[model samples]
Target chain A: MPVLHPEFWRLLSPEWVLVCFGTLFLLLSALPATRGAKRAIGVMALFGFAVVLVLCAQTLAALSPGMHVAALTGLDGQIGLTVDGFSQVFKFIFVLGALLTVLMSFKYLDVEKAWTGEYFTFLTFAVFGMMVMASGVDLLTLWVGLETMALSVYVLAAYMRRQEPSVEGATKYFLLGAFSSGLYLYGTSLIYGATGTVQLGAIRLALMDRLAHGGPAAVGFPLAAGLVILSVSLLFKAALVPFHWWTPDAYEGAATPITAFMSVAPKAAAFAMLLRIFVVGFLPLAPMWTGLLSLVAVLTMAWGNIAAMLQNNVKRMLAYSSIAHAGYALVGLVAAGRSQSNQGIAAVAFYLLVYAFMNLGAFGLVLYLQREGSAGDQMDDFDGLIQRSPLMAVLMIFFLLSLGGIPPMAGFLGKLMIFYSALDARLYLLVVVLAVTSVISLYYYFRVVYHMFLKEGAPNLPAPSAGRPLGWSLALCGVAVLAIGLYGQPFLHWASQAVLLGR
Target chain B: MTIGWILLSLMIALCALGVVLARSPISSAISLLIGFVGVAILYLALKAEFVAAVQILVYAGGILVLYLFGIMLTDNEALRLTRQTHLQAWPVFVLILVLFLAVGHKLYHSDYTPQQPDSLLMVTDQSQVQALQDRLAQEAAAARHATNPQRVARVLYGDYLYPFEAASVLLLVAVLGAVFLAKKEV
Candidate 1:
C-alpha cells in the first residue's frame, strides 16, 4: 500500500483554502441569519481570494528555480497534481480575476435586485475549480475540474432566472457544454485504448516509442482522431471562432460582472489546460496540430475582428474582441509548438495576465454605467461621456487603448511579446494576420472611444455614479494595466519563470 | 456466441432508433429503458459485472424513475407539442456514419496485441520464454480470482483517488447549481 505523504497536502494548500471557503460560503448562504449580509459575504469572499492568491505566490516563492513539485503520486509513481511555477502563475491569475469580479459584483447585484448569497458561493467554487484545472496533471482530473468550473458558470449565467435572456443563454451554453464534454470523454477513451495509459508522461513515452518503431504510421488513426477531438473541445471552451456561437449571447445575457469573469478567469484556465495537455502529452505530434491551430488562429482573428466591427451592442462587441484576443494568444501557442521554446509559453502567460486586467476593466466600465432598468450596453449609451463624467471617459479610453494595443499600455507589451515570439518561430504568415487583424480590431475599440470622447451625450442622460467597491475594482484594473505597461519587467520575468516542466 | 452477440447488437440498435423516432414522450422513454437494459446486458457479456449492475441501477432504476416523474409532472399536451424536430437528421446521420466507418476500419486493422516480454528479448531464449509464460499464467490466475468490483475499488481508491474526490466536488457543485436555479427564492 502506498501512503500519501503529508507534504502533498502542504503543496495543495491553496486549493484547500478555496474548497473550505467555498463550502463555508455555501453553508452560510443557506442560513437565515446571513440573509441580509450580502456585502459582508462578498467581502469575505474577496478576502478568501486574497488568501488564495498569497498562498499561490508563497508556493511560487517556495519552489527553487527550475523545480516541479508533484503534489500527489500514485503507486506507479504517476503524478496526479503538480505544483510548479506554471500552475502557480495561472492560479494567481485566476484568484486575481475572481477577486476583481467579487469586488465589482457587490454593487451590480444590488443594482439588478438579484442579491443572493449563492452568487458569492458559486464564485468561490468556480475559482476553486479553475485552480484545480491549473494544477491537475491527469486527464480525468482536468475534466472534472473543467466540469466543476463550467457547471458553476452555467448556474451563475442563469442566476437571473426571471429574465428570459439569462435562461435562454444558460440553456444554450449547457447543451453545447454537455455535448463538448461528451466528445472529450470519447476522445479520452480512444486515446486510452491506443496508448494503454492516461498519464501524460506515459502517453508521451508511448507516442515517442510508437513513432520510433513504426514512424508516423505506427501511431495509428485512433490517436490522431482523439487528438483532433480533444483540441476541438478545448477550442470550444476558449471561445475561438467556429466554436464561439455561444459566446456573444452568453456574454450579452449574463450579468455584467459574470461577463467580466467569464471573459478572463475561465478563459485563462482553459488556456492553462490547453498548454498543459498539448505541451506535455502531445508534444510529439506538434507538427500536425501546429498547422491545424495556425489555420484556426487565422480564422479566429479575421472573423472575430470583422464581426466586432458590425456589433452595435457594446457587450457583443467586446465578446467578439475577446474572441480576437484568444486568436492572438493562439499565435503564441503556435509559436511554442514551432519553436519548442519557453519564450512562446511565457508570452502567452504574460498576454493572459495583461488581458485579464484590461478586458475586466472594460467590462467593469460597462458595469459602472449600468443603471436600474437600463443595461447601458448600447454604443449610443457612451455618447458624450467626456461631457458627463471625465473620469470614467478617461478610464474607458485607457482600457480601450490598451485593448487595441496602443503604445505605453499593457496590451501593447502583450502583443509585442506574442509578435516577437511568432517572428522568432518564423511563422511569418501568422504574424502578418495577427498584425493586420490587430489594426482591424483598433477600428472597433476606437469606435467606443470616439463615442466616449468625441460625440455628444443626449441632453436628458444622467451622469453615472460608481459605487465604492466598483470604483476600487476599476481603479485597480486601470492601475494594473498602465503599471504593467510602463514597468513590466518584474511581471514579464515572472511569466518567463513559468516554464512547462515536461517529462 | 457470435450469433448471440450479433442479435444483441441488432436489438440494441433497433431500441436506440425507437427511442429517437418515437413521437410520444412516454413511448420514447420506454424505448430508452429497454436500451439501457440492452447496454447493461452487453456489459455483463463483457465480464464487467460491476459496471453492468451500475448500468441497471443508475440508468434503468434511478434516472428512468426521474424521467417518469418529470413526464408525470409536466403537461402531456405541452410535452407533445414541444417534441424536438429533427430537420438536419439525415445530414448528421451521414456524418456520424462516415466517422463510425472510419473508426471501425482503423480499429480492425490496428495491431492491438499486448506487448510481450519475448518481443523485447529478441533472441527468444528457451528459459526466458518459459519464465515469461509462467508469469503470464500466474497473472491470469490472479485476475480470474479478483472480482470486477474489487478491480474497480482498487483503481478508484488507489491510482485515481484524487480524481475520485474531485468528482465528488463536481457533484456537490451540480447539486448546488440545481438548487440555485430551481429555488423560487434564495
Candidate 2:
C-alpha cells in the first residue's frame, strides 16, 4: 500500500470535475425550460468533457515520466485509488470519446424524436463511470465504476421508451449485466478470502512472494476460480465471443450516437481495467490465464466476423464488427500478458483510439441517413450512396476501409502493431486466426463499400441532410483517421509510454 | 443457536423452492418475500444488524411491494408456467452440477474457516465447560461493540469519500433515466 502524497486530493480533480458538471447538468435537466434546450445541454456536456480533458492533460503534465503511484492506501491499508500513466492515457481516451459523442448527439438526439435532457445527464454520468474505472485500484471501487457505467447505458439503450425492441433490449442488457456483476462480486469475495486483501497491488505482491518462497497452497484453487469468474465478467463487458449476445440488440435498439459511444468509450475503459488487473496483478500467473484469453480471442474473432457477414441491418453488423474489434484488442492483451514488454498494451490502446474514430464515423453516417419515422440503417439504404451524396460516400469509404483494415487507414496500423506483438510473443495460431478473420471481415466491409459504389438503384432514401454540427464531427474523425494512418509514430510512442508500471 | 440457523436455512430453501414452483405471480412474490425474511434472520444471526435491517426494509419492505404491484398491474389469468422438456432440463442440470462441483471443491479443499460469533456454542463437553464459560464471559466483557451501521457510515464518509460521491452521481443518473424512460414525455 502506498502512502498518500501531500496533494493526494488534487490528483482527483478530473473525476470530481465530471461529478460537479454532472450534478449541474442534473439540475439543468430538472427545470423544464432549461431541459428542453436540448442543444444547449448537449453542448454543456461537451464543455464538461473539454474541461475534464484539460484537467487530465494537466495531471499528465504534472506527473514526471516514470512517476508511477502505487495503489492509494487508506485506513488499515485498504486500497482506495491509483493514478499512473496508463490510467491517464485511458482518461484522455474516455473524455475525448465523450466529447465526440456529445458533439454528434447535439442534432442526432432531436432528430431521433427523443427528449434530450436526461440523455446528456446519463451520458455524462457514464463518462464519469469510465473515468472512475480508469483510476480504480481496488476491486470494489472498480465494481462500483462498472455498475455505474452499465446502469446508465441500460437506460440509454431504452431511451426510446415507445419502441418495443428498445425496451426488450434494455431488459436483456440489464438482466445479463446484473448477473455479471453478481459474478464479479462473488469473484471479489473469493479473491479477498484467498489473499486476505482486495488491493490488487498487494494481491500481486502476495502471490509473487508466495511463488518465490513457499507459502500456503490453500489459496490456489479459489484464486484460480476467482480469476476465471472475474475475467468472464470483464469479457462480458467487452462483448467478447461467448458473452456478446446483448451487443446487437442493445446497439440496434439504442440511438445511433449512443451505439457509437458504447462501441468505444466503455469498451476502452473495460480493456484498461483488464490490462491493470491481468497484467499488473495476474502477470505472475500468466500460464493460468493466457491460454483461456487466447482461446477467447480466437473464438471471438471467428464468431464476430462470421455472424457479421450475415447481418443486413448495418447497426447490428457494426455491433458484430465491434465484437471482432474487441477480439483483436484481446489478442493484444494476451500478447502483452505473454511478454514482459509493453508493446501489446500500447498496441491495444492505439487500436481502441483508432477504433473510436472509425466506428464513430460509421455510426455518424448512420445517424445522417436516419430520418424521422424510419431507421435508414438497412443494407438497401446504402444503394447508390455515391451518386446521392458523394461526400458521405467518400467518408463512409474511409471508415469502412478502415474497418476492413485497408492500408492508409488508421485501423491497418492498429492491426499491424497488435499482429507484430502477437508475432513477437510467438502466438502463431492466433496470428493465423487474425489473418483469416480479416479476410472474412473484408467481404462484409466492402459489401457496404460495394453497396455505396456499385449497387446503383433509385436513390430513394432521405436526402443526406445531416446538419452542420454532425458534419463537422464526422470531418474531425475522418481527418483523424486519415492523419493517424499517415503519420502515427508520435501517437504510437505516447501509447508505448503509457503502460502500467510495477509489472 | 445452531438449531435456529438450521430452521432459518430450511425456511429459506423451502421459500426459494416455492418461488420457483408456484405458478401464479402473486404466489411467487409471496414466496420471495418469505425467502427475504429468512435471509434477514440469517443476517441477524451473524450479528450484522445493519444488513439485517436493510435486508428487511429494502428488500422485503420496498422491493417486494414493487414486485406485487407489478404483478397486479400485469395480471393475466391465462398465464401459465411453461414446462421444460427433459432435454432442456438435462442441460441446465448439468450446468448447475458443474457449477456446484466447482464451488464445492474449493470449499472442501481450501482453508475456509467459519467465523465464530461473540456468543457461545452449546457444546456437550463437560470437561471444558468452565473454560468455555470463562471464554464467553471474557469475550462479552471485551466486546466494544461498534455496530455495523456506524462502521459502514464511517467507511463511506471517511476512507471511501470519493466513491460515495460518485455513487450519488450514479443514483442521479438512475433517477434521470427512470424519468426519461418511464414518463411519456420527459
Candidate 3:
C-alpha cells in the first residue's frame, strides 16, 4: 500500500506543473506562429513559476521545523528524492530565478529575434532540472538532473544560430561540458565501486561502518580519490578555477537574459549539489576533503578575481566574478564541514539567495542596455549612462556597489555571513583569501559604475527606452536586493531553517 | 575453464589492438566491431548472457555502423592516416596496466581464487551440500529480484518518480529546442 497523505501530492505538484507546461509549451512551439505562440508561452511559463513558488511555499509552511523526520512519504527509500526544507527553499529560488529570467528576456528575445516558444520551453525544462538537483536523494537522480540542466543550457546558449560568436561559444561550452560530465560519471562509478551503494544515505552508513571498524584503513585511498574526483566535477559545474575555462565563452555567447539565467540558477543548483554530497555523503571524511577543498577554494578565488580584472567585455568580466562567487560559496561549504551544526550551510544558502538577486540584476541591466543586432556588451557601452536615464543609471550603480559588497545592499550581507562562518570554523587562510579577492572584485564591479556614471555614453546608443515589462523587472530585482540588504533577518531566519535539511 | 579465460582475454586484447592500429575509418570500424564481438564472448563466458547479447546487438551492430556512416559522411574524419596516434597509446596503456595490477594485487591478497562456490559444493559431505544449496538459492533470489523489470520499475517510479518524470520534460524541451533551432527557417 502507498503512503496516503493528501499532502504527499503537494510535494510533487510543482514538478507536475512544470512538466505539463513544458509539454504544452513544446507543442505550442511546434505551431507556425512563433512569436505569438511564444508570447503566450512566456506568460504561461511565468504563471507556472508563480504556481510552483506558491506550492513550494505551502510545502515549507507545512513542514515541522527542526525535525529529522521524512519529508517525502514514499519516494525517499524508493529512488532517493527528498521532499525536505532544503529542496523546497532552493526550488523556490529556482522558480523565482526562472520567473525573473523570463521577465528580463522579453526585450532580449525580441532584440535577438529569438522570441520563440522553444526558448521558454527550454527554460522550463532547465528549471525542472535544477529543482531535481536540489532535491535529489541519490547520486543517479543528481547526475541525471545535472545533465538535463546542462543539455538544455547548451541549446539555449546557441539559441541564436546566425551569430558566429554565439555558435562558437556554444560549441566550446558543449564540448567542454561533455568532457566534464564524463569526469563526473567516472567519479560516480569509482565511488560506487568503492562504497557498494549509490544512495547518499547508504554511502554515509557504509562509510561510518568502515570508520568504526578500521577508520581510514578501511575507507582507504581510492574512496578518498573518488571523492576528490567527484568534487572536481561538481566544482566544474559551479565554474571553479582550472575547470572553469568554459564560463566566459558560454556566458558571452548566450543571449543576455539566458546568460543571467545561467549565472544564477544553475550555480545555485550546483552549489546545492556540492553541499549535499559533501555534508551528507562525505561528512565523515572531512579531514581528507577539507584540506583539498580549501586549496581549491583559494585557487578559484585567485583565478576568478585576477582574470576578471583583465577582461574588457562586460559579460566575460561577470563570468569571472561568478567564478569568484563560487569560491566564496566553497568557503561556506568548508565551514559547514567543520562546524557540527547547520549554521555554515545556512550561511551558504543565504549567500546564494543574495547572489542570485545581485547577479541577475547586473545581467538584466546588461540586457536593458543591449541594442538590436549589436550587443552593447563592452564597458564603453556603459559610458555616461547617467545622462540618458538617471533611474537606470542609478540602479546600475546600486547593483555595482552591491556586487562590490558595499554595506548598502544584500551582497555585503551575503559575503559577511560567509566570512563570519569561515571565521567561526577557524579557516583563517581562506577568510583572508576571501577578503583579498573580494576587495579585488570591487575594483572590477566599480569599473562598470565608473564607466556608467563617470565616463561618457557612446554617441550612437539608441535613445534609452524603458518598456513597462523591463521597468517592472528591474524594479523587482532592485527591491529584492535592497530588501535582503536592509532588514535581512527574516530572510536569514528562513535560510537557517533550510539548513536543517542538510542532515 | 582457466584456459578458456586466458584464451578469451588474449583474443579481446588482440582485437582491441587491431582496432587502434587500423588505417582507414572503415577498417578501424570493422576492427572495433571485432573487438566488441570479443567482449561479447567474454561476457558470455562470465555467464552474463543478457549483457553478452546486448553487447553484440548494440555496440557491435548498432553504434559501430553509425560510426562508419558518420565517418563516411563527414569531412575531416576523426580517424587519421598517421599512426602518430601512438601519442594517446602510451598513456592509455600505462593507465590500463596500473589498473590491472592494482585489481590483480587486491584479488590475490584477498584469497578470492580459493572461494569459488563450485569448488566448495564439489565436496561430498551432505551438510556441506545443504549449506551450499541454501546459499546458492539466496544468491539466485537476489539476482532474480535485481534483474526483474517490475522490481526495477518500482525502484524507478517509486523512488525516482520525480527525476523520471522530470526527464520526460527534459526530452520534450530538447525536441522543441532542436526543431526551433533547425527546422524553423529564418
Candidate 4:
C-alpha cells in the first residue's frame, strides 16, 4: 500500500514543482516573445520557488514534531526519500537561497540581454540537484545529486563563452571538479567495502558496532571514518583551505547571479553531507577527528580572512569570506560530532540560513553598483556609493558588516550561535580561534565600507547605468537577516528538536 | 557466464587503451561507449540484469551519444589534443606513479577479498552427495506444505515498485534532456 499520507507524497516529490516550472520555462523560452514574457517567466519561477519553500517549511514542521514519515513505505530493503528535520532545515535554506538568486537574476537578465531559455533551464535543474543533495539518503543518491548539481553549474558558469574569463573559469572548474569527484567516489567505494552498506543510518550502526567491540584497535572502523569523511567531498565544494584554488577564478568569472548561487547552495549542501557523515556515522571516532578538524577550522578561518584583507576585487574577497564561513560551519560540525547535544548542528543550519541572505544580498548590491566602466564587483567601484544611491549603499554596508560578523545583523547572530555551540561543548580552542578570525575578517569587510563611504570615486564612473531593476526582491532576505539576528532563539530551539525523517 | 566475464574484461581493457591512444573526439567517444557496454555485460554476469540494461540504455545509448553529438555540433574539426607541458609532465607522471603504487600496496595487503562459497552442491564426492540427498528427502517429507516459491520475486516487484518507477522516470527525463540539448537550432 501507499504511505497514505499527503505530506509523505509532498516530501517525496519535492522536485515536482521545480521540474514542472522548469519545463514551462524551457518551452516559453523557446517561443518568441517580448521581454515581458521573459520577465514574467522569471517571476513565475520565483513563485514556483516560493511554493517549494512552503513545502520545505511544512516538511520541517512535520519532522520537528518527531513524525515518522516512512519514505519507502512498501519497499522491502531500499530506502527512498526522507525529509528529516535536518534535511528539512537545509532544504529550506537551499530552496530559499535559490529563490533569492532567481529573483536577483531578473535584473541581471534584463540588463545583460542574456536571458535565454537555457539559463533558466539550467538554474532550475541545478536547484533540483541541490534539493536532491540535501534530501539524499544514501551514498549513491548523494553522488548522483552532486554530479547533477555540478554539471549544471559548469554550464551556468560558462554560459557566456564570449566572455574570455567565463570560459577560463568554467574549464578550470570542470577539470578540477571532475578530478575531485573521482577521489570522492574512490573514498565512497572504500567505505562501502568496509561497511557493506551505503545508507547513512546503516553505516552508523555498523561503525558503532565495530567501535564498540574492537575499541581503538578496529582497523575497519577508523578506515571507514576516513573514507566517509573523504566521501563528503568537502574539499571540492566547500573549498577547504588546501583545495580552494578554483574559488578565486570561478567566483570572479561567472555571471554575478551564478556566482551568488554557487557560493551558498553547493557549500550548504556539502555541509549537509558533512553533518550526516560526521555527527551520525563517525561520532565514535570524534576524538581522533575533532582535534584534526579543529585545526582545519582554525587555519581555514585564519587563512581565508587574512587572504580577504589583501584582495581589491570584490568577488575575490567574497570568495575568501565564503571560505571563512565554511570554517565557521565546520567548527559547528566538529562540536556536534563530539557533543551529545544537537545544538551544534542546529547552529550550523541557522548559520547557513543567515549566510545565504548576507552573501546573496552583498552580491545583489554588487549587481546594483555595476556600470559600464566599473561593472560593479570591485572595491573601487563602491567608492562613495552613499553619494550615488544612498539606499543601495546602506544595504551594501549592511551586508558587508554582517559578513564581518558585526552585531545587530544576521551574520553576527550566526557566528554567535556557532561559537556559543562550540563553547557549550567545551571546544575552547576552536572558539578562541574563531574569535580571533572574526576580528581578522573585520579588516577586509570594512574595506568595502571604506571604499563605499570613505574613498572618492574617479570622475569617470558614468553615473549608475539605466534600466536597473531595484525593488523588494532582496528586501525579504534583508528583513530575514535582521529578524533572524534579533529573534533567533525560536528557530534555534526548533532546529535542535528537528529529527531525521528516516527511520 | 565465465566466457561472458572474460569477454567483458577484454573489451573494457581494449576501450581503456583506445581512450588513451585515440586522437579524434569520435574515436574517444566510441571507446567510452565500448567501455560502458563492457561494464553492462559485467553487470549482467553478476545477475544484475536490470542494472545492466539500464547501464547500456542510459550511459551508452544516451549520455555517450549526447557527448559525441555535442562535440560534432560544436566543433566539427578535430582539434589537436594539446600535450601537457614537458617541464611539468615528469612531476605529474611521478606523482601519478607514486599514487598508483600506494593504492596497489594497500589493495595487496588488505584482507578484502570475499571467501569462496563452499562447492557442496557441485561436489562429486559420492558419500557427501548421498548424505545431502538423504537430508533433503527427510526435510522435504517433514515440510510437504511449501506453497510460496515466489516470495522473493513478490517482495522485489511489489514492494519496491515506486523507486523502480522513479528511476525509469529519471531516465526518461535524461533522454528528453539529451535530445533537447543535441537538437539543432532553426
TM-score of chain A of each: 0.97, 0.96, 0.96, 0.93
Error of 4 at B44 (Å): 5.4
Query: Model 3, residue A309: displacement in angstroms?
Result: 0.9
Q: Which number leads on lDDT?
A: 1
lDDT of candidate 4 at residue A224, scale 0 to 100: 45
Docking class of 2: incorrect
| TM-score: model 3 vs. ground truth | 0.87
lDDT of each: 0.84, 0.80, 0.78, 0.72
Q: Which CAPRI category fits model 4?
A: incorrect
The segments of candidate 3 whose C-alpha lies over 4 angstroms from its true place after superposition are A1-5, A66-76, A460-462, A500-502, B1-23, B31-48, B76-162, B173-180, B184-186
| Maximum-TM-score candidate | 1
Which pairs of residues collide in candidate 3? A78-B159, A79-B159, A383-A456, A383-A457
C-alpha TM-scores of all predictions: 0.91, 0.87, 0.87, 0.81
Assess the local accuracy of residue B148 in candidate 3 as a C-alpha lDDT between 0 and 100. 45
- Candidate 2's displacement at residue A111, Å, is 2.4
What would the DockQ be for model 4?
A: 0.08
Per-residue lDDT over A191-263 for candidate 3, one digit per residue giving the tens place of the 0 to 100 score? 8989876778667656766766774567765676677678888988899887899899989988888888898
On DockQ, the candidate that comes out on top is 1
**Model 4 per-residue lDDT tens digits across residues A190-297:** 788787766565565565556556654564543644463474365567787767788889888888888999999888988887676666555555665575577778
- Interface C-alpha RMSD after superposing true interface residues, each candidate, one decimal: 8.2, 12.4, 12.4, 12.0
Of models 2 and 4, which has the larger TM-score?
2
| Clashes by residue pair, model 4 | A84-A500, A84-A501, A85-A499
For residues A372-417, what per-residue lDDT tens digits would candidate 1 score against the true structure? 8888899988999999989988989889999999989999999999
Q: Rank the candidates by lDDT, best first.
A: 1, 2, 3, 4
Which is better, 1 or 4, measured by lDDT?
1
Best of the two (1, 2) by DockQ: 1
